[model samples]
Target chain A: MALLEVTNLSITFGGLRAVDNFNLTMEKGELYGLIGPNGAGKTTVFNLLTGVYKADEGLIKLDGLDITGHRTAEIDRDGIARTFQNIRLFKDLPVIDNVKVGLHNQFNYSTAESMLHCGRYHKVEKEMDEEAMKLLGVFDLDKERDYLSANLPYGKQRKLEIARAMATKPKLLLLDEPAAGMNPNETAELMETIQLIRDKFDMTILLIEHDMKLVSGICEKLTVLNFGRILAHGDTKDVLANPEVIKAYIGE
Target chain B: MRKTQKKTLITYAIVIIAYIILEIFMKAGMMSSHLKGLLVPMVYYAIAAVALNLCVGILGELSLGHAGFMCVGAFSSAIVSQLLSGAIPDALRFILALIIGVVISALFGMLIGIPVLRLNGDYLAIVTLAFGEIIKNILNSIYLGVDSAGVHLSLKSQMALGLADDGKVLINGAMGITGTPQDSNFTIAIVVLLISLFIVQNMIDSRDGRAIMSIRDNRIASESVGINITKYKMTGFVVSAAIAGAAGVLFSHNIATMQATSQYFGYNVSIMILVYVVLGGIGNIRGSVIAACILYLLPELLRGLNKYRMLIYSIVLIVMMIINWSPALRDKRDKLRKKLMKGAGHGAA
Candidate 1:
């Protein structure tokens, strides 16, 4: 059975159908890519899936359990995590704290225990610190763990956000425009990091990218969306070769 | 130690050392009686300011109904203490009063937080402001009395309770609660302040604190990370309210008669607490305590200045704001701190 299945997911705002009858099915550990021109509603689909926006009509299921319209935090607890296009880190906090926030649910200490620094609080906090440090190490951010996230350079900030998401231990990870603002070298590094995270963590990934090179290098399957609907989807090369995909990208 | 943990330790040490020094000076007759009288109030207000900071600074929510929660604590605990007077030891009675005040105020916090926390920014502030006014007005007109039969309550006055001649009027409408045991002292106030600091500081360093701060930093990001926003928001708000309530109990016991007037539990008082938090530096627990103590005592200390007292106070406030928030000064302070830390080999090595 697929790890995630979305059927007839549709939403409209005012008169515009932001997403229309979007359907997706993903087996465990698949690396998928979502591509679209600007305003093609790719992010809207992600928003709907993550429960930032409710779909007007549809069903979203993970591990065969219906999860449509669940709260964003609930969806995350159910093993789904995502990175934002704008890179939202707790700017004033240290990089490790940002990752520790992603590990929020894994700690079993009660508020009273934490406030008194007793029992589970000490044990769980030590464990979380170790875990957060490990995740930061994976992204080459362990050295910068004590620095405030806002002080980091752009590429590291982006990588830190993904590392933070990984701390949630999600079964499926979503990346919205992960390569939107990167130099060629940084993009190449991100591509390797993304591949490494997927393999080492053994988690499925669905990414939205404008960088075709990054998409082609890492994505196993591709889905092209245009005006809130899927235009073509299949093997990466075939979808990229479709005449419809070309016109959508070039604005015919 | 981590940088933040070390900072927290230094803050606590500074507060405790300063308090001890002041106490020593007072014992040596180096301080005036007016200054001595201000000590207990200074500690209580400092505690309240810390509580307010948890909401305004840490949780990143502007709450103006803090005075309302304080009032709830002040009245309920005052009544309990009055009822238990002569039957229990003063120390035990005072402790129970503080606990009762905390419980009552925390309940009010949760009750108010449920609907108000749903609104964000200005709307939340407005609702809390309205709640503060509502609580103040309700306390003004209400009359409460205890008799052999049981408790009696009325809105008009003592006569409305229609009690027996032996009955005691606990709350006399607009006159507020009277004859409550004055068990508050400098030592008790200081102990309360320390407890408040312990709770607020430990909370800020804890996992729950991280969740609260993350929500404040970015709601969408925090939610996406699987944090229950309502639960964490309530945690901060209720804990803050409980602390404020404890402070209120201390306050009521220090004064001869406790009144729930606008001057006491009004919008301005809420704003004053916010001012303390803001002037001290938001999310800085140590700053809140210092700001509260200095600001609360400044007027009394400057009483000899007569007409210029408020003027000097206002100028101090403005200067504090500039010092705390001015970008240039902040940058300089950060640089100085980094330099000192590096000089001490505190940086990553």
Candidate 2:
């Protein structure tokens, strides 16, 4: 069974069909890439999947569970975690806490316990710190764990966000233009991290990107979106070579 | 973790040292009775400021109805203490009142938070502002008494209550509750303040605190990461309200008479508490404490200035703002501190 299945997903903003008849299926541990030109509604599709936007008509199933129209947190608990196109780390909180917030549901302590610092609070907090530190280690953010997330340099901020998302322990991870503003060197490093993450965590990944290098290097399957419609869908090499997909990217 | 622990310890130390010094001054007869009278109010105001900071700074919600929570605490606890005066021992009665106050206000917090939190920014602020005034007005018009006939409540005149001969009026409309037991003292107020500090600081360092703050930072990201936004927001808001209620308990118990009035539990008081939160450096709990103490005492201390009192206060407020927030002023202060440290090092050498 597919980890995530979206059938006939569509949304409209007034008369404009922002995302129309979008269908996607990802098998367990598949690395999928979604690429498109500007205004291609790629992020809109991610929003629909994450429950940031309610789909006008669609069926979203996660791990055989019908999760259509569930709220973002509900969908996340049902096993889908995502990073934003514009990096959204808890800016005022420390780097470790950003991940610890992601680790929130996995741990347990009541409001009273947290307030009074009694009961299971100490043990749970220590465990959270350890788990967060280990995740930070994976992203090489351990050295900067105590720094406020807003203070980190751009590349590291992106990595911290991904680490925070990964901390949620989701089965399906969505990366919306994870390498959006990176130069070649950082983009290459990010590509390696993405592959490493898939292998290490056995994650089913879907990412939107304009960076062809990172996309071609890491994505096994590709789906091209243009003006809210799928232009091509196949293995990465075949989809990229398709004349229609190429035309949407460069020009006719 | 160690850094935060040390910082919290410093905050505790500051409160403790201030308490000790004030005690010494009082024992030495250096404090006027007027100054002594101001002590409990100052502490409670500081406590209220800390509570407001929890909501405004940490939860990232602007609540203009904090004084309403305080008002709820004050009245409910006062009534409980009054009714239970002889049934429970005095200390125990006060403790029960405090607990009841916190719990009742927390309930009010959750009730108000449910609908109010759905709105954001200015809308939330406006609604809370209305709620605060509404609470005060409702309390003002209530007349409550108890007798062998169970309990009597009236929105009309006290005569309408038609209580039994031995009936005791707990709350009189407009006049408010008179003869509330003066169970609160400076020491008790300070102790409550310390507990508030402990709860807020500990919660901020814990996992749930991180979740609440994450919502404050970004709602969408927090939700995507499986942090329940509504639950955490309510948690922060309600806890903050409960603490404000504790301060209210202190307030009612310290006063000879507790009244629901614009002077005490109005929008102005809420805004004043907010000023403490902002001037103390919002999200800085210790800063709230210090700001509340100094700002609350300033006008009282300058009463001798008479006509110039408020004028001086306006200047102080402006100075505090610049000192705390102005980038240029902060840079200069930082440089000065660094130089002072360098000079101290040279002297040691």
- TM-score for chain B considered on its own, for each of the candidates: 0.95, 0.96
Model 1: per-residue Cα lDDT over B179-283, one tens digit each: 888899887888888888888988988899999999899989999999999999999999999999998998899889889998889999999888899999999
Q: Give the TM-score of candidate 2.
A: 0.97
Candidate 1 has which clashing residue pairs, if any?
Answer: none
Candidate 2, residue A172: how far the Cα is off, in Å: 1.1
Misplaced by over 4 Å in model 2 are B331-349
User: What tier of docking accuracy does candidate 1 attain?
Assistant: high
What digit string (tens of lDDT, one per residue) describes model 2 on residues B1-349? 4889888999999999999999999999999999999999999999999999999999998989899999999999999999999998999999999999999999999988898776656566777789889999999999999999999999998999999999999999899999999999999999999999999999998878888999899988998998888889889999999999999999999888778999999999999999999999989999999999999999999999899999999999999998999999889988998899899999999
Q: Interface RMSD of the predictions, in order shown?
A: 0.7, 0.7
- Each candidate: what lDDT? 0.91, 0.93
- Model 2 chain B is weakest, by summed lDDT over 10 consecutive residues, at B116-125
Error of 1 at B80 (Å): 0.7
